[model samples]
Target chain A: MEAPERLGEVVQASTDRFTAQCYRLYGAPPLGSLVRAGEREPHVYGIVSSVTTSSLDPTRPVVARGASEPTEEAIYRSNPQLERLLRTDFEAMTVGHTQDGTIHQYLAPLPPHIHAFVFRCTPDEVRAFTQRLDFLPLLVGARTPPGDEVLAACLREAASAHDQPTEFLVQAGRKLALLLGGEMQRLNTILRRLPL
Target chain B: MTGREESPEVLGPQLLGVVVGGSLSQGLEVRLEDGGVVEELKVGTFVTIRGERHRFFGMVTDLGLASADPRLPSALPDTTNPAIVRILSGTSAYATMQVTPSLVVGGEETSLLLEGPQPARSIPFHFSRAYRASQEDVQAVFGAEDERHIWIGSPLDMEDTRVCLDLAEFVKRSNGVFGKSGTGKSFLTRILLAGILQRDVAVNLVFDMHSEYGWEGGSEEGHAVKGLKQLFGSRVAVFSLDEESSRRRGLSPDYLVRIGYDQIEPQDIETLAEMLNLTQNAAQATYKLASRHGQQWLREFLALEGREELAALADQLGEHQQTIESLRRRLDRLNRMAFLVERSPEDSVRRILEYLDRGTHVVLEFGRYGSDLSAYLLVANLLTRRIHDSYVRRKEQSLGDRAKEPRPLVITIEEAHRFLNPQVAGLTIFGTIAREMRKYNVTLLVVDQRPSGIDEEVLSQVGTRITCLLDNERDIEAVLTGASGARELRQVLARLEPKQQALIFGHALPMPVVVRTREYGPRTYAEFGFREQAELAREAEKDLKDLFG
Candidate 1:
């Protein structure tokens, strides 16, 4: 498969103007571009979603950043090991001064798949998958708007894979997907209007 | 002038205004104030003006205020306002003394005097500050600022401190919480757990039917996930139905149990057996077969190679074929009951016993488990057995040295009414625990919303009751009756709000307190929900993509 164009490099050519323009439109690049500078992994870019100052320790501040979806999942999966690194990265991005304090931030990676469906799996299947990876493929839209549809579709697909997808699962997923799409559109619209 | 000094003989009848029949003295006419002659003072307007004291204390019986001449010279003008003076009757010394020296009827300066001791000072029946446990005191005892430790929101108030308890004494031996839905019963449950955990002294064994307490502050992606593990460490063990753990061993699926037709007390059992394809004779023989083969006898009995083998065995047993056939039929019936029973592992039972033996805080997280009812019953039974065994062992050693041994463990069962059903088995293992555990130092903290649903005998055995607000009158009444000193508990219950609990009876507390539950650290079941964690993870993933990609 052909690799996508180096969009980052193409965008970087006009960094000053772009930065100035972006600052004028939205505020500061709330997150500093560490990856853009080639200091960190070139493929990885951290976006500062929020900067929270520490009330307990003035020196320690929290910077919430977005990570790639895979990276975020990894963080969750290996939480015990990654906590300090994420905390440090978050603090470095957000913290202006250092004092004895704690910082909190989420390192979420961009999702590889934009839309994924979730469905109920048999206990045996759930066990099989869960045991293999020590992590379950969580159903994202199990409760929310798109979640229900995605979950329904996922269940239907799973059932069909076994040649016995229940009619309920099939229909439920299709209907749920429509509902979920509408919810997603609404959420997107809301996010677009927000300052972030 | 004294009446004794004035002789009636000296003043003859003629002079005394009696002067034979119709005397002039009797015919004397008196002009009324309103220019109308009246025989006696008006009922409401009667006033006896004391000339000596120049004061009047009497009712303005009629509408004399409007009718009285405005131009008439008023006697004691400041005191003649009828609105300010109420008409007084039933004149006794007590009433008269209230008016005091201000009013004197005769020229001799007569005054009513009070002679006896004054009545004791009346104090309104307000709750004494000493008796009323304040939110601050409760917070001090139970509240922790850490998100992992606190159950209620910040800025704790009286609502956060409402505790329910019986009125018999300062400590409640046992109490429960029961509500239909959305009555904040779960919130109250969390508060109680948080309170106990905050003390850091008591070890809690929370059988979480619904995985509420296992996760406290950390979401699946963030703090709670890891925070829970760190905070609870070995103290908390989550036994989900989906997986086998050291603590989740030994739960037998109800279907696997051989049900004898003779053992079927109710028609429901017979129907259930029939639904499972067991003939009456087979059902009757099930008990004998199971007892002789031991507990796992059903599994071995079901493992008979084929129908041919089973038939051959039936022939070999000849006279016992009826019983064997019954057993075989009942085995088929058990398939339907598979969901109800869980085949408990020996290891899980041993692990729990180990915890009890070592006196460690163990929370069996059965929230994710499929068969909750069976899991709870099994754990309850296993714990009871271990407790009994330990007690027996300790008793044998205690005749020589009673004072030196460690006390038995205390078990806290959240949502206790679910397992301790009196209607089902007459006395559930939980009831047995309540009855027998006290002697072994194995205390039970039974938590539930419907206090009435719990077995009355078991409820009676509870020594410390910490109650929250209960809306159901029947539940309140049951709690009041079951708990000692519960007469005054209603007052506390009436005032309880969400998260507020009355600690009437407990070893540590003196009086019932409206207490804000302490903040629980991130390691409690209340904070953990698998679905919630998944959602958080999804959100985190999305945020990462938006920022980086």
Candidate 2:
């Protein structure tokens, strides 16, 4: 099998979430995308919840310099040193972990170690991981500010990995309706955002 | 309209759901499966539950919509979106049906085959799967068409599956056919009578008040419907009280029934007192005059024209003068009836008894007299009294010899409440037969629209009650009296279609069933083995020639 492409390295970790810093500037995976850390057993999986591009060091605040340039690309092209000062990183809520070749759609026993390699999951891996919807409640109950939107986007992203995306979204929407019982407003918002 | 081909899979019974909670008295509550659409499941339809130890059969009496959360109604989902509607239907909101389990067959196939179905005394275990009853389940419960079973109709939505009646058990006791006017009560009664004659379980003596059961009757659509005589040929004998009226209807009645003044006993007066508007004292005075004037009391009394002669006779009999005067006034109406002669040459009661004794079913058509309730009450009371007496004497003589026991007689009476009301139910012979309940090998098939007017005691004794749509609360209550699970059956009974549908429950069927009553057209006529009139005449002529040659 081909090796999954590496995207970042885990810079900060916790029992329920982890922060991964991209190797290249502005190279963070899109929000709500599935990504995992660790190259061997006990792979930790999560959904990308948010992304940031800021100074590598907290004390050094980067200043904007594109006002005098004719175009934004020209400003970036003129400032080669800016790439060394800025870094892109994303925060993902830990949704599941794998052990013994069996995927467990729940919190890992221990957080991923810092500096562990993180890779964006392949379409086949995404489909296999989402074969069962047990991990839906984790995404729905996340502490993210726009939790329903994040959950909807994650479903849309996972749906494309399946042969029949509409059927997959409908199944996921029904499960959300059940989990969000009496929360019709939340369910309606999520269903409206579904690709179907 | 949708080009939907009705495949067997779609028409056949599909899995409904599981029995969630219920009791034997209130019926089981079934939570519908996701595939079961609530609108598709109708009330009064048949359902079968596969319990662990038994296969329970029942009717869907009620339907409901429920949700896992009580706030679903106020917090409604987006219904315009088909995806949202589909998703929220079965998961967050679900449908439920209340099933009244009536009969249960055993778990083992061998046991079910040997023992048949029995009343469901206990409920199925929780979560037992309930389904739309299949044709095989219906056949298993209500046996196949055979010598002893008659196909009465098909259950609602199960047009291809026949729900039969046990003819042998049906004739064992008096049954009733009740509904509001114009609800096909007459047609349903005809079907039952035809079935009884076809099965030969018992011989029926019908007092056809409307002249419908003797020859042909017109349906609501003005179509001619055949009567029992036309269907049964030689097995049925038609007796008409109005020969001219029968002839006008193209009927050749076998016998003309004429009641004599002497045959009009004082008891017959008591039965007709309500219909004739006779006062209690006026009705009671007939007995005094009968004892004083002897066998020709009615004829002798009607001869007293002037008030002075009546007063003198009333004083002689020690009755009040005014009471005698009013009694004479009421008895005078009988003189206008052409069927009531001064003295009849032939005994109509004895003729009817002879026909009944020979296993020939008799239908006495009242013809034009059917409009006059008093004439009907008098003749029916007189003839039934004598026939019942003879049956009692014969039944006693054949106590040990079953073969000699008189054939079971089911007397069909229309406008039955007039004879079976509380005032005269005890005094009338029809009421006596209903109460005695086949003791003398005689039963009644009481057909009426106003069951509430019938004596409650008599109504309770009716074995099987097949009723059409009855909007009157009292009538529905009266028909459901003394029935087990009457509360659930009340809902089913009230919802019956105004025509060509009936709720049949009681001694004849294993469970209560709502049926689209079998069509009473050419198909049913063929089923009853009816031959053309010319063919019957030809056969009769052939028999006569062979006998002489």
Candidate 3:
């Protein structure tokens, strides 16, 4: 397997989630992509739940300068300082963690440390983590807006990592059915997003 | 996934479900596996539950659908989507069934093979896996066909496996074959009769009301089906009450039974009171005349020529003239019966006894008189009373010598309610035989459609009941009156097909089983040593040529 692609560094952390700053101004991973943050063993795994790009300083508000430029690239070329001033960060909800090379589909005892390198998991890692689908209920129970969409996106991404992606999604859908049995409307909304 | 647990390993390919709840009396509840299609599980199919240490045999009595959440039904999610249907079927919503455990085979494997199955007194533990009963399991429960056991048919949905009845035990007590008219009661009765005759378990004296058991009876498709006489040849003797009707049907019976008027006792008249619609005064007047005129009462009474002579005789016997007139009116119905004669040259009862003594089964076809219940009631009552008396005498004399005991006799009667109903059950000889005949070496094989009309006591005493489709609620209740797990068996009995299938339970079977009754055709005939009609005709032709030569 190829080396895991480096994505960001964790800048903020909590028991269930962490915020990571990307290497470039707009280098955040796509929503629902799985990422691990750690330099050694016991890497905390999470799914990208949200993303944002803003000035590094909370009090600073940068003004638009592209009105007179022929395209957006010209404004960037004229203002090279803008890339250094702005930062891209993504929030990931912790779904599980790896311990002694075994992926446990549950919360890690401790959150990722500040500035821990975050890496986009390889297809093999996603396949290994989604093998059991025991972590589905955690995504379903996540306290976030568009939780259903994030869960569906995560499943779609995991499905692509398996030999029989449709079969894997069907199995995951069955687990979600048990989790959301009483909420048929919600379950239907999530299942409709799953690709054939 | 928060509370998920590993699924148990299914022990066999036929694994159906796992036991969840229930009791020994109410049956067990099983939640079907996710891979199982609820449509494939049918009620009345046999199942085996593998418990911690025992294997419990059961039948699927009921099936239903359940949802994990109560609001699923009202929400009514779109079921047209395949994904939604697939996910919700076994997890969010699932199928459950009720299994009534009937028999239990316990102990080590070797001991279980030796001891066989016993009645289940306990329920399987929770989560015990249940599977469709394999052929070997069913074979172990219902023993293989042999001399003492007769293969009746296969259990429901198991065409290759067999369900045998222990005929040796079946003949020890009176049994019943019940179904509504045209439900193939006659065909099932024929099968049982053939089995009994083939095994020589007991000697049968069938009062064939429709002449269906003597010569050849018509099947539901209007084709000729062989009767006992045709199947067993010399081993079975056909007696006819209407010689003309028998000859018209191309049957030359071995004997033509004629009941002499002098042989008609007061009890016979009393037994016919219901069929003849005789009043209480008329019924009593028969005893009065019998006491006065002795054994020739019926003959002398029918000989009375005028109203004045009857009045004088009524006055002589100290009976009311109106009562005597009523008795004369009802007794006149018997005079129209052709089988009744002024004096029969030979005793039909002795002739039957002779045939029975020779170990030959006898079927007395009622012929044209079968439709007349009065004639049937009179003759059946009269002959059975004498037979019962003779059996009692012989059985009493053979007390210390078991070998001298008369061969067990199974007297088969159709429209059994007429002779064994509650009103006349205590008064009729058939009722006596059904109640306490085991000691006297006599039992009854009752064939009837309206079982509710039979005496409840007699119905309870029916050791084994092989019942076909019965639509009436009362009839169904009557057949399953005293059965254990009757509520479960009721569903099985009611759902039986209108033809060929029957639910047999009681002494003959260890547990209640629904059977697709064996086909009564050329194969069965050949099994019982019956030659084909064309072959028999050729043999007869050869016999004629030899005699002439």
Candidate 4:
């Protein structure tokens, strides 16, 4: 089951199974974090490919950083009004959605419904999706897709959420070792960043 | 360093970088690890990626330092800010390598380094761990042995490890030793011959073209490198064409190779023409004269003293008068070589065959005659023709007599390109033997520096090629033609040390290997059965004492 907190709402849907639009809430999901949406049995699942925050007003420019701030979290806390001015959005590559209950790693038979309720996938959902690591190749590509950081963040979250954190990491590492035998740099980066 | 070999903590070479990029045709891209704690892999060094059920074998073809952003210079950035320096130092910047997978060996048996199809996927694993191949991995793949296997050289990475070559397969067809001059061609040939001789697999007949295969040959520093005769005395009978030169070198040559001038045929004279600087018409004159006067043509032609008689024969034969004179003048020089006698001496070809039939190796030393091109060509061609013809006949005779198996013979010739060059190959008997001498129980161990000059037909027929450094493009291509994985090995071949390294591949070896050739002096004698020979001699002495004392 997905978490009750709505991570985002599908703002725009596409006939292209690869892409979708989401209006992010106060907390945007981490890159590569598995998410669920769509109002029907064939709910759409995706990995976040990118995340960005922008000013809602067309004429104003927004800046998140300033001097004399102890930390990013402190700035956010001190300026709650900043959130109203700026809205968060994210892009998800629809790797595979679920029909009834089985996970998949291919494009949906049909486009995801518009304005579907999108939410963060629970730890169990993430584990089930990663059962065989079939999604790994879908996320990685040759043309420097900025896939490393996304993969690392997802792996760290998934490993920490598993029953045996270190063992899960080792298992994933072994799978990645075989899957990325020739892609050492990408592999090492993902491996070194495992939460275990 | 502390982990057991089988343990997860196994101490082997570690990764330097991620394989973030590259295509199949261009090659794979790998970033090196941050530091250089591991052994720096050379261009030809082999590395392996451990997949779930398979191990991928790859050769490192190129190494370079690279940056993620092309605009960024690779040099460490010069900056005063400590924070910037710290961040820059930890950046994803380091050495990178281009790796080419030549083989992907994996199966339940795990021993076979199979030349199978490349894996379906370009990358076997998402992030496979790489380690330098272990000794067991190498041995299982390369050191698989059988009775016919002979250890030729050690692998470049594995010290004191012997790499075995399948000799039975190697001797079944012709083979060659090719390299640039001074690249240990002779030394490698000597080791190969030693394997053949010590195994008693075949009898060898070496045409010592430079007088180098018999008692002694010059080393790179001009010191004497011991030759075949010194290494295996009684087993190898060393014969010389020039008796005085042999004696001058203080060698007791087993036989003085003598051929009656009457034995020289029209074809023999034609082969000698290149050395004699004779025109085609002059060479044809010898044939015309031979047909006119039969076996006594040389003597009769020499006996013709008057120009009136020469003019009469020239008119009668429709020959140019000057061509006839030039033929006679060139033919006259043959009398000056000491080895060509007009009359009685032992039949040299018969003697050589008898020795070979008895399974004794023969190295025919040209001695001073080796430098005289005309004499060497005439004698080598005539003798090789006779031996090859007799072997063919003997093979025919033994077709039904399994008990009387014709001894397998391997004829060793230097400057093989001279006899096997395309221009002369059709007429040269050595080329015939090179092309098709297998079923007759004969083969050639052709030693030459210029393999490119050898006839393509003959080169194509050569079974195995053990080449030293060859900078010539054609020679390298000729040696590597039809060899498996030769394209990847070209990088390896180019980097061989000019002295004692050789790249051995083809019919005999399981795979292409670049090895440091075995040292020839004491190490060679020790490893190649000198101790076994001594034990046999001691046992014979004991048996004699037990019978009589």
Can you give the lDDT of residue B1 in candidate 2?
10
Per-candidate Cα lDDT values, in order, are 0.37, 0.88, 0.88, 0.72
Best by DockQ, which number?
Answer: 3
Give candidate 1's TM-score: 0.39
* Candidate 4 segments whose C-alpha is farther than 4 A from its true place: A1-196, B1-9, B12-39, B49-53, B56-68, B72-105, B109-130, B144-147, B531-549
| Candidate 1 vs candidate 3, lDDT winner | 3
lDDT of 4 by residue, B1-549 (tens): 111224445466455445667655555666554425224677656566665666766667667765444444533333363322322321433466776655566643334445532332444454555555566655654655456676777777777667777777788899999899999998888778878887777888999878887778887878776777777778889988878888888888898888887888888887666778889998888888899889878877877877788888899789988888877777788878877777637899999988888878999998777777677777888898988888888789888897677788888888888788887788788788887849888898898999989889888889889999999888888887776556656777888889888888777765566788877765566565554567779989999999998
Q: What TM-score does model 4 achieve against the real structure?
A: 0.68
* Model 2 interface CAPRI class: acceptable
Which window of 10 residues has the lowest lDDT sum in candidate 4 chain B? Answer: B83-92
lDDT of 2 by residue, B426-460 (tens): 99999999999989989999999999999999999
Q: Per-residue alpha-carbon lDDT of model 2 for A1-196, expressed as tens digits?
A: 5567798899999999999999999888878889999988799999998899999999988887988999988988999888888999998889899989989999999999999999999888989988888888898888569777779889889999999988788788777777987677677778888867
| Cα error of candidate 2 at position B237, Å | 1.1
After TM-score superposition, the amount by which residue B257's alpha carbon in candidate 4 deviates from its true location, in angstroms, is: 1.0
TM-score of each predicted structure versus truth:
0.39, 0.90, 0.93, 0.68
Task: Please give, for residues B1-549, the per-residue lDDT of candidate 3 as tens digits.
Answer: 222353545564477889999998889999887635578877789999989988899899988888877777776656887766776778788899899999986544565677789888778899998988888889989999899898888988799999999999999999999999888889888888999998998999999989988889998889988888878889999999999998898779999999899898888888888877788878888888888898889999988988999999989988888888888888888889988998989999999999998999999999889999988888888899999899999999899887779999999998999999998998899999999959899999999999999999999999999999999999999999899999999888888998989899999999999999888876678875688889989999999999996
Q: Comparing candidate 2 with candidate 4, which one achieves the higher TM-score?
A: 2
Candidate 3: the clashing residue pairs are none
Task: Please tell me the TM-score of chain A for candidate 1.
Answer: 0.20
Q: Give me the runs in candidate 1 sitting further than 4 Å from their true place.
A: A1-196, B1-202, B216-230, B239-241, B244-287, B301-346, B402-407, B424-427, B484-488, B491-495, B498-508, B519-549
**Candidate 2 C-alpha error for residue B201, in Å:** 0.8
In terms of lDDT, the poorest run of 10 residues in model 1 chain B is B88-97
